[model samples]
Target: MAALHELPSQMRAVYLREYNKPYELVTVDVPNIRENELLVEVHAAGFCHSDLQVIHGQFGTKLPIIPSHEPAGVIVQIGSKCSGPWKVGDRVGVLNFKNACAKCVGCSLSQKRYRNLDPRFCDNRETAGFQHDGAFAQYLAADPATTVLLPSSLSFEQAAPLMCAGATVWGALEKATSGLEPGATVAIVGIGGLGHLGVQFAKALGFTTIALDSRQAGRDLATEVPGGLGPDLVLDSTASDAAEKVLAFTKGEGVAAAVVCTDSIVANTWTLRLLRVGGVMVPLGLPPDRWQFDADVLVFRELVIRGSYVSSAESTRRMMEAVGRSGVRSHITTVELDDVPGIVDMYQEKNFRGRLVVKMRD
Candidate 1:
């Protein structure tokens, strides 16, 4: 293995020793890099809603695990078997899936969306934070194949949320925005963590983006784009005339697509009314209960409802490029590693703005 310097034997980490419990701060051994892996000294890791699901026994009991799959940091070591336009000290973000299985989130949509993924990678992989130890620590052993180089201009905190939140939304938008004509319109429903990013991506990807949300903050964030270029319109999903407003915006045809980013069954089911015929609707949230939709709308409109679990490594790189070109950025609130447990409830609140990230070190 190639390394920058003598590595530390131990590091501080947040450990999930049990389900439905607060993560505990503890010391653990720094991971060693494999020939095809990279040892990253994590600078920032994003706290996602999925992380809360993990703690709530959503993915089953994989006890004594480190949380936070959204990892961005400096590569401190590279495995001898790893080769690319990379070396130690490069800033990087790791795709959580080690080797995507067909049933896994990556392969579920990445194969069809990107068409660059291998079927051989389908069905026998471990996912970071779920099946394998993830980046709630100072260091992470990342698979080189699933890692992307980060832009030098982006901070680790800024880049960390993009690893999953940004990539997942970008992947979902890719499903609907592909081949879209110029001036085509898309609506981002529930502009929260992922939805807010979806608005920027849709606008950047050549679609007339319309932001829809129940909360004023989320709707407000939709218009908070850098360079004074925000979504074309913003609507409160909870508004009585929300659906009518969209229909009117698209001249009674509706948007070219509608991405429902909230887990609200109401949003998931109602947003279907806003898609044009043959439009796509990607449910980006993981709701606790089943989501019911109108079957007649599905058959008549031919609306494409697809599942986008996460994005491929190549697609993630594409998203980074979009970030550069569009000046899209995550509205982040940083907290030290030790402060994570205390703020878990804060992120769970409805008024939480932007992403909550853990700043591991300088």
Candidate 2:
């Protein structure tokens, strides 16, 4: 066991005591560092829509859990068994997925190289914030393997979103367009946190980027990208001819691929029509209800539909490097810890712009 700190024994944390309830700030025992874990003094944590899902009892997670999964912090202490490439004071971002049974086939395969026969094979996997304590608190015990060391150039607030949202989009894009040639027409549907990052990434990768969203604000933000690359076209999905508009923008041949970043079934349905023959649509959002698509359209066009889950730690690191080097970054608004509950309510009402980060310390 490590020696106890002579300083404060209790720390402030945002915790939920029950389902469908707001997170409350309370003093709890500082978490103990495990042999493979590092004690991270959390600086900032990003609030994701999935966090709202967990809070609302939609994801089947247990009650009385810490909410934030996108956490970035400084390592205050390291465990006895910890070694190599990390030390005290390292700035890092923590991922939500933790230890898996190494004996399992999925675990044995590296994330970049593995191909599982079944998508549901890893269904029983454990995750932080869902199976273990998460970052909505002042301190988090993060597995060193799951932590991505952030460059000193990135601030904690900026790095927090990369832990989850940034990595997710990056990973999805990598998978969806692995063999994509330069100048391929790519459409990003939604233009929220993940979609916004997806647009920037697609543009950076030399694709002809198009932004699709229903809101004027989203289109406005997408158009303001530096150097005016600003989406080759911005289509307002709310318009009656959204699919036609997209097809027209692609010169009636349709986009080479589309990444569905929203959970809306309507958006998914419309996006399918905007893909050329053999084009792919990668679905990243988790919608509540089931959706259906025309079988003939899929069969005749030979269009591919796939779903992408959260990204791996290695990809997460690459995402951070990409963010550090490019002008593309998440637009975040900082909020204090005490204001999280209210923010959650506002998020439910869909009232905020960009991503929200909880500042754990002054």
Candidate 3:
């Protein structure tokens, strides 16, 4: 148990009191820890577009919930029955999926590799920022099994977004680049939170990275520093011959892999055209509409289309370790916990750059 002095009974939080309504600042009691759980004192939380979708009732969310999934913090209290490696004062961040059942048939099929795809999935799974009360507060109750330790070199602000955005792209990139050579061409479409990270990871893995985006900022960020953390090439998806440009650049062969990070149907459709024969297309973004592709192209080219969600805990840890060692980090804008409501407004308006992390301690 944590000393009473170390924690308060009530903490400040932003609550989604109703669907399609603005968040309200309120004081709520700190969440109780269950067996196999840790009580984390949140240092920082990351605002995700998924949270915005929930606020709009896109996920049919339950009311009066605390939102924000990307949370990094220190463990203050451990449940009596907790048996994992967790301890008080340990730095940790929450994973996208929490409380997954390890006994499902899907778990048996993938041998625990793709439990998130189990038919019985979500029956026992609790998702942070979606199906459960999340980290938009000073404290969060986390499953030790779903929490990742942060490296000493990573700050709370930098580690928060890695829990979700970084992990999602890492998983997608891993799938996209599987069985491909290091020098193979990889295209990251969208150049947003997930897309940007995909570019970084692809570049780090020694692949020639190509970034696809319609925005000048995306093209700019995809340039190598002194310029930025950029790709080897950038394709402007807005151009009439954008697909043709990618094909021409690849000598009419297309890239080895195209990771679609945007939910835009157009962007998703473009992934098929941007890949070489037998190349994999990984779509990680959730657009509000169904993605349409040419069946003839898919059949003739023998292309692969796969959807990747949040990564496994093991993958997340590996990504964090790599980020710490390689100096890979997310571009973030920090805000106070009280600034969450306005942050949501900015997200809806698409006015921010990179990720927005909320500092709860200040």
Candidate 4:
């Protein structure tokens, strides 16, 4: 089409190719958009640990796919069937879900907690970076329904992680800290990307937050990084009496709620133990293996352990607005798309800190 011809015939992109192998950079045709899709010129894509999993064959994603779901870009073309308030030249961010059928049970129920749990949605869902070709490229076609408008004050680099990191933690925090009055105690059990953002959100929401990490380095990150103003209390997760310390910090009643963002089973369990009776624990991380949770504490204390999946489209929109209003942002180290392979290696060795975002175009 003449509209498509106005754009480049081919664009640079990275391909997964083989499992546990270096991603290959190659030129590929600009994606053609469906009637309900928007062709976005990606400016930046956030490098998430989930992308690392796709590289390591851990997630078993369809191979030879482009990975990196947290992308922010400008719309270059709009499809005929695409509706809503979006238009060309609009800045937008793509969420984890490519599309969700409105007729699904999840949509009908309209329960935010079950946003990603409904089989009707989950069974047919296409997850960017996990199920669909993601944003590790120059251009991508995204469903307008799943994309949200970016705040004018936010740069692409900052807005990119909101697509996943920000949205996921926001959903978890809303669930974990619901009905928590100001000055209420809340714990974030992981000072990495997700935990760090959780701290910012908790603080912004007026909670007396505690930062927890297994290592000194992560604790320092929680305190030093921008948007990671050290919480009221910092706890050593590896300490033998870590849970006891949390209990003591909250006047022996334990935290009103905690959001566990670590994939470590022990960390998840520790946070669960750190909750007060009837307290809420929202687990957002994907652990490597199935864990046998403590049923004794569950039944005795009547504690609630809720599982949080990626996030609903509505959560993503609200997160962007909150981030813009609250001035909460991630500490991102920008790299070019060409450095994606090296970034993957850095992730594998756990060498990088904060979050990495690829500047797809200058």
Candidate 5:
């Protein structure tokens, strides 16, 4: 790998110069790679809703920042003090969270209890495209610890969405089905970017997967899963008695769990009714606000309700392995770097479906 100092001083990047405005293509200084960091030549970056949130100031982001989180690339340069087996020319997937202070209490617990909890201990923590420059650029500097080495067979475009969307659903599924036996039944609510991937992951884990979406279009797209491992049933939530339809599909036993991937409180509230006794409902998507439910439902059903954030590097690796074993493909539409602004507009209008990948490398 080339040394970091040997790289050029500036590179092309997409920046959100102002909130609620379009991202502009501009040349910015190549990030100064830390001793333990690698300068990656970004190949592909996935367009996530969170990026739009940051762009619109929904997340109170600092302006003049790059707006992207799901990035995959090749190591073009390694910092001087960097160590480990990784070398230049290695393809890698980037994690959103940057560096975690190893000495903090949370970091200790994260390392001892669960490495995925490391974000809690992240002191110099900078989420890509938010506090720091993200992968909507030609080059990105990332710590080796947070970057996962991708297999040679995995393309950068394929690995991009897995970094975020795949990890989010994978983590939620892991939490939802921790004690679940093989062949358990699971339902995924809202078959969008996260839900579509969630369906495949659930089925890969040996669950009877059911997908629920608002539109017949989404249902049609989800029903075409590879090898007929598609959803056992696809239902439109717009239809009357949607919850009853789910119950009917489950033979009246209800699903062992339902993953809510929509940021709709109504959807989350109703999805709880679809869970059987002792069933879990894990929310990965952000709702408008704290959800309110009837106390009777919670007490009578003894349902397990929880929220899952992005997964850690370990869980991400597990997700990647699952995708590798299952040969799952991301149904992505490729757009050039210049199209980011227009795509962001489409996203704000909620007009696109499936996952969108920005091809930074042309």
Candidate 6:
């Protein structure tokens, strides 16, 4: 963890030395599992925007760590301490935030607020692929605390993205659900990778959903929602009268919730305009700089802003159920494990929707 132990001049290699460099194919031993860990034969791993930030040193994560946090696979081995129903050869999906230390504020049951939410906020947690090694390898040491049994109906390729991207948006939607009545209107802004899934989640929850995005492809993806689950409508967020259209569609009351999946401050600003009085807004994207909002929108309309929250275990199971029922799926572009470098470049250069995943095996 300390800069690869300050390699000597003769041993210093060009890559795998630090962040902002290409990852090399390093032959390391298969990860070993601890008492609470499960040795997962990773069938698939997902690429997230945060993975990009980690590589760029934005999160200040421990350097020289295996990246890609989303892993869906079969359990090849389980530690003796893992006494749940989990067993060898069982299909599974792991949440990135694992190895929860129960005493921390984030993990303590008394901290009801954080208890059901992400464990990544726990001060002492060891996040796979972030604070330490991750799922990019053939086998990852996964914690049972954050691992969920993948539904038999779901394939590993699709299940991998659900581990993060799917759970994240679902978490936001769950927050939005608490603040609304049954079948309220909700708006999903920015229909890219996260937004596309957001649209399905909103629809599956029976909300009168609206999909918004400037990109034609994003708008199109909304209509092409898997299993025909719909947002009910798709509107270009960039239109001059976009807010007006949404307000009129909602009978001037505006949507009950607006989930902003894009990182653009300008686009996020537009979402505030679509919210009715007391409407909640959940922004999932983490932009580099702080978000700027008009104080008047918050004060006058009494609009509420919230972050995504739900028990890592609970959210994964609920998301799996939704996937099973409504057939929600990721529009993933998968690359073999060895071709991750190419996927990294594609994520940066290509304007694509949904997730980029690594297929660890055939």
Best model per lDDT: 1
Give me the overall lDDT of model 4: 0.82
How large an RMSD does model 1 have? 2.7
Clashes of each: 1, 0, 2, 0, 0, 2
Query: Which regions of candidate 2 are displaced past 4 Å?
Result: 1-8, 108-125, 224-229
Which digits, one per residue and each the tens of the lDDT, describe model 3 over residues 1-362? 55224678899998998887778889989887877678899999998888888888898877778898999999999887775777688998888566657666555665555644432244567777887889889999887767889999889998999888998999888888889986899999888777778888888777888898998877765663222346888878888988887777788989999888788888788678778999999988776677788998899999999877777777788888777767677878898876777887776564456888999996
Residues 1-362 of candidate 1: C-alpha lDDT, one tens digit per residue? 77889998999999989887888999998987768788999999999888888888888947889998999999999888885767888989987887544576646665775565632256778778886789889999988778899887788999999988998999888887778898799989988789888988887887888998888898888877676448999988888998999899899998888788888898889998788999889998877798798999999999888887687787789999988777888889999988877768879777789999999995
Error at 299, model 4, angstroms: 1.5
Please provide, for model 5 over 305-340, each residue's C-alpha lDDT reduced to its tens digit, 9 standing for 90 to 100: 877878877788788887878876677788888777
TM-scores of the models, in the order given: 0.93, 0.91, 0.92, 0.92, 0.93, 0.91
Q: After superposition, how far is residue 220 of candidate 3 from its true place, in Å?
A: 2.3
Candidate 5, 361: how far from true, in Å?
Answer: 0.9
Give me the overall lDDT of model 2. Answer: 0.79
Write out the backbone clash pairs for model 5: none
Arrange candidates, best lDDT first: 1, 5, 4, 3, 6, 2
* C-alpha local distance difference test of each model: 0.85, 0.79, 0.81, 0.82, 0.82, 0.80
The residue ranges of model 5 lying beyond 4 angstroms of the native Cα positions read 1-6, 115-117, 120-124, 348-351
RMSD after CA superposition, every candidate: 2.7, 3.0, 2.6, 2.7, 2.1, 5.7
Which scores greater on lDDT, model 1 or model 5? 1
List model 2 lDDT by residue over 10-44, tens digit each.
78988877777778888888887778678889999
Off by over 4 Å in 3: 1-5, 101-122, 224-229
Clashing pairs for predicted structure model 2, backbone only? none
Cα-based lDDT at residue 81, candidate 3: 79
What local lDDT score does residue 342 receive in model 1, on the 0 to 100 scale?
A: 74
Cand. 1 TM to true fold: 0.93
